[model samples]
Target: MANYKETAKEVVKLTGGKGNITNAWHCVTRLRFNLKDKNIPDLEKIKKVPGVMGAQFSGDQFQVIIGNTVVDVFEEVEELLGGTGTGEASSNEKEGIISKLMDGISGVFTPIIPALAGTGLLKGFLALAVLTGILDTTSGLYQILNNLSDSVFYFMPFFLAVSSARKFKTSEYLALAVAGTMMYPTFLDIAKTAFMDPSVVNMTIFEVIPIPYVNYSNSVIPIIFSVILLKHVHKWVRSWMPKSLSLMFTPMITLVIVIPVALTVLGPIGSYAGEYVGKGMTWLFDTIGPLGGVVLGATFPLLVMTGMHYSLVPIAFSNRAVLGYENMIGPVNGCTNIAQAGAAFGVAVRTKNKEMRQVAISSGISALLGITEPAMYGVNVKLKRPFYYSLAGGAIAAGAAIFFNCRSFGGGGMPGLMSLPAYVHVEDSMNVVWMAVCLAIAFFSTFILTITLGFQEDAAEEVIAEAAEKKAIKNGTKHRVFAPISGKLQLLSSVNDNTFASELVGKGIAIQPDNGEVVAPISGVVSVLPDTQHAIGIVGDDGVEILVHIGIDTVKLNGEHFDFKVNKGDHIEKGQLLGTFDFEGIIAAGLDPITMVVVTNSSDFVEIMNANDEGIIFKEEELLIVL
Candidate 1:
């Protein structure tokens, strides 16, 4: 995690420093910059930044792809920018309307997606509860659960307003006020009455202008369009009004002028636009039927690649708002995700490179859970054939889903196997079941296709060494890490702490020490030996930065029940004494005694392989190989 912060610093420096960036934002997998001088930063140098997966100038923006840790990096960059003397970045480079629209949509939607996805999953679980007969819908707990899930969709306008306001550079509180008006009880109560009563008609404001009963709940486009207008209006009002009056009267006048227009004109325009788009999609699918799904399904990966997939987000939201469910972009997108996951899984099984296999398997799991960027970029796109096979798999899966009446009734933003429960329809209980069948079809079809249709593999998995172990650590000489003091060897993923388990610190093995004894795993200088005596770091002759930590959160013990023989900068030999800790004391202190040995500079190597020690391991045994 700290490595990504350093990555942020490197990225900020590489991208013409803090001053060069005018506007910056992030999507799921990338940090996008609107630079004052886009040409100043070299793409190659940007790509070489430690945490960056890739870098490119996409259309009118400079994009630095950073998987998973993009948010953390974005925050760090923001903090760095704030610490210095700065002004807003201004850019003169012109962009097309389409590019600008895409940027706007991405900026506005990116911040709110996590909320949507989280609540969406909750909604899915609630559906499962209903289906399993575990809870009656009429029960108090179910009632609370239903509204808890509904809150986000019902207040979507507020979320959109905050994000859109920031994108448009307007007052946040005023934007909230506008959202408040849209969801006001006065209007919502009337709209509900109109739905039930036959004689109710459109209400006239000042007995002159008629305002349509547009349900603001679950609405998106209206608030976005409204905020765009608000940006201009706020500026205009501030320019004309007294600066002293601006603190109060300006908002009053702005709301007075904007709310009426929103209800009477802009609201209806956005409302109709969303309705027509929903209707248009319905018509297209109905006329050509399953063929329409085939085209969209096959092209979903390309959409993800070019970052144009976000363009479909609003349409999907709109469809859910207007038509109560969307057949496109939700369940169909999940099928494609499953297909991509399957393709990555196939690559994982086929590739001889351990590193590539690790990446493929992890990315494939992420795809199955609903995020596909890692799988798509790290594995399938690189292999080429897996990507193509995925398209076919997605097409067939989507066609099957549509044919079986699977649709996204919940409108969850993250689509995958986990979200299949969102397809459940009370009137048609088979909806989720059909979607599961389709996703399974996606996985098996693409997996089989990839294996049967093989592609060219990487040139080599193991690095070829030129020289011997006496040379510099950079040389690709075979390196071994012996057991420091082992009991049962466990994968790092099993560690309770995220900092270690996520491999944010580094990658290696965790061990449950049979006794208190600790020894050096490698012959090297003791690079870091903390006073707390819970951890030690060594730099191996093979250029591996090794760290051995005793137990989880043992640092909080403040040197309790610990002793060490080594000091920082002391030269240590392989299997030599380093330290000892009371594992029984640590356990009694309510802490985990799982010791860890990690290669801190793992990315510097071609591959790191385990020496195959599983259970009840002894001391001074070969544990890991570094190449």
Candidate 2:
């Protein structure tokens, strides 16, 4: 992995800096920015960042593809820029109703996905253990594991409340209060008692009004409705309340009025709405037979691409709560996800273009893990033909799902193999068997179709030439890398750090410093200079990325005895002073004083080899040869 902090800094700078970012957020695989002016940012520079996968404009949002490490990079970017962007992006200008609604729901749910996915996996594993008799259901370990798995879902309303508050730009504490009240022990007890004995429920609140007793556990829609209502109501109250007493009375009055209203009106309304949606889905499936599945499966990606997919999220949750299983979502989702992977794999196999092939293969693997945006945007949709192949595959697999009556036993963030246990019906083993079959069919059908129908052909030579030009190097291209410090040259393997010794950070040679000064190894732009000042990243004009580490684990010194002479993005020629470090101080701190000069982008070249005999070397001497 690349240093995420460095990547974050570069991304922010490339996107017109912190000043230009009006708002920023991230999803599973991309950093999304709402810029003051999109044209001011150099999108090309953002795309060229070492770890970045791709960049594009999606509607009003400028998206940077950072693969799976987006969340970490997002946090670092936020910290580096001291934050830019507001959560009030819901009021985006001229956005369609569906687009805004989808954006809002996605914004609310995206942050919650990690917890949901983690617990979902644990839940699935627990179920498997019990089913296979590896874990006794009555055992203490089982009880502990079961609660660990179920805690997230059981208190889902609380999580949703917090996330929805941000989406609506409301007080998170107030939203959480609503959720807490709904799930309070007193409320849960009353609701449960009422369900067991309907006569005990107080049907008449004031002898004329009717109120329903309902448990809000594992529910989604009610809290969202309540919080959104709270935002507007809280604002109205604040507008009229006395300024001196506003803080005290505002929350008091808002809670007193909003809690009852939400329980009596909004909460029930959401439940009824959920019931109707569940009924509508059932009616569609029942009335149209397998045709409904085929249509939904085939059209799922289009819905996702248009940002309309979030509309189905609540329905899936509602189905699990009301029907104990979701027939409308899980089965088709499995097929669609697998189909996306298969289509991308097909592209990888059929495309002669090296870049496209690499992207397709990598994104295809991500799709299989339930993250499909990379595959969908980076490969299938880009190629056009592969997307159609995926749709065809999804349709066929979903038909099989309908025939088998496949369903999900629970609801969570994303649907794929990780959530397969959600489809397992203990009473009917066929559910698991058929779900697996559906995935297999989707993968194979899409793969075969994409291979057969192939993408529109580009001139083979032209495709190869384009890739070569982008890399800025041919098979025989050579570049010289000079020693960045006067030191004893040594094999990279002789370094104490495994990251350097194993060549995972990249192919490189190491040096035992005789002095403290480090210089530029080649004429290049400084790409990254981290805060600790222990390492520097230089992007050579020849496209090689060189990293010079001052000493092993010297970052722990916290710049105590080190000083960097150059800042990020500065241009420097070979032998120019880049930094000075304390070699003896590092040894006194019990750290290895070995310096590493690595070709971080060595894979882009045909060969990168040590040029000098391992011994004393001076700055400006030939150190490495790249071809």
Candidate 3:
């Protein structure tokens, strides 16, 4: 793999040297860039770079789809981009109803990926062992593995507590405290007693009067509902308590108020709400029956793209808990994932671009492993055609699933091949049949569609070239100047931070400028100007691209203190007025607008040298080097 630092530097050079990259992190795969500027970076070159698979923009963040080695690459990228890290900001805000709903669902579910994958793998292995007769249910090994697999489900509240705390920006310990209340030994004991003897108990101790006990372990809604209420409880308690005793008294009172409300109302209500939602979904499937599968299959790809599919997890789990079986969503989702893999395989078969072909093949494999983000974001979303093919295949699989009356025997989200054993109930022997049919439809339909569509080799090139050209232009300019706010001018190379000094993936000079209005360093054609108004990209007379990224991932500021002076594609000259900005207002709004003068097209340059020192720089001072 190419050095991650080198690749990151190239990216920064491509971005015109000025991007406020506040934070960087990675998941099992993918290096997520939370850039200050909202402009889409050079995703194409980032993909072409040796270590990267592909790059994509999603959910107000930039995701670089790297495979298993993403962790290693992330370390290198961090080293190159300085080590400063920031917490991921919530994507939720005032938006359209559907958008907000989607954001909430994504936020709630993303943190659970590790648990789901780990448990799924264990379950898959257990099934393999049983099928092979290597282990029997009566064996000690079976007991051990069963416990391992079941622990994730039993202690799900703990997992959800941590994830929900991050999502809600609340104390993780506080969330754990709330989760503990629900899963406390006393609570479970009371629940067990209540189940055995209905009339004996008074109100539960947490409440004024004895109430019926409900088991909260392995439950989803109660904890989430409780945490949501806890946010308000915490906020209200903190406001009134004396400073000295605030910490201790606040949590005590918050719990005193919130816990009872949770047990008395929210817990039961949320549980029923989940149950009803699941039933409603099942009812829709029943009414539609086989046709429902086909409809869902067709739309599943789009739903995944928009991240709406996560909302179905709670419904699936709830149905499985309540009915000991789940119908509809899981089967459809499995089919969708299979269809995605099939489509990617098709691309691999048809495409000649070595890079696209490799990505297609690897992405297909990853999808089969149950991580579809790489395939869905990198290959399917980019190609557009494969996504449609997956939709068609999904519909076919859905039809098969519904025809077979497939039902899940265990609780979970999507049932893959590994979890198939748990889903097989003797009464619903049709599940096996449906599984076969779904697999067949998903695989065959996508395979055939991809062959029919063939690979559009030309399309990939068009996109790739456009992306590369943008990078080249951004990096090619000589002597690019920047406005230093009447303060010390830090050489672009002297910023010491890995992201700036090493030029990993973004470009521009860092300055401790005197606070004032930021103007265009060297005017050119504006390439990108986002709605957030936090940054602008300009292409100069020399075919060099310069991006003036105004602030550090301040897109979240919602355009509060920014004013744009140029439209995309507008032409201007040196020292031209770009726009007026509120440095103090942005800071007051809790944002950092660090202006960077970057050369987006750096590939054409033989060498780059920095000229300005720790002094005030006029608008046209010789600040950068180009050969």
Return whichever of 2 and 3 wins on TM-score: 2
Instruction: Give the TM-scores of the predictions, in the order they appear.
Output: 0.72, 0.69, 0.65
lDDT digits (tens) for residues 183-206 of candidate 2: 999878888899898888465556
TM-score of 1: 0.72
lDDT at 280, model 3: 88
Candidate achieving the largest lDDT: 1
Tally clashing residue pairs in candidate 1: 1
Against the true structure, candidate 2 reaches a TM-score of: 0.69
Look at candidate 3 and tell me the lDDT of residue 225.
78
Per-residue error (Å), model 1, residue 269? 0.5
**Could you give candidate 1's per-residue lDDT for residues 556-589 as a string of tens digits?**
9999989998776566789898878899999999
Every candidate's lDDT? 0.82, 0.81, 0.68
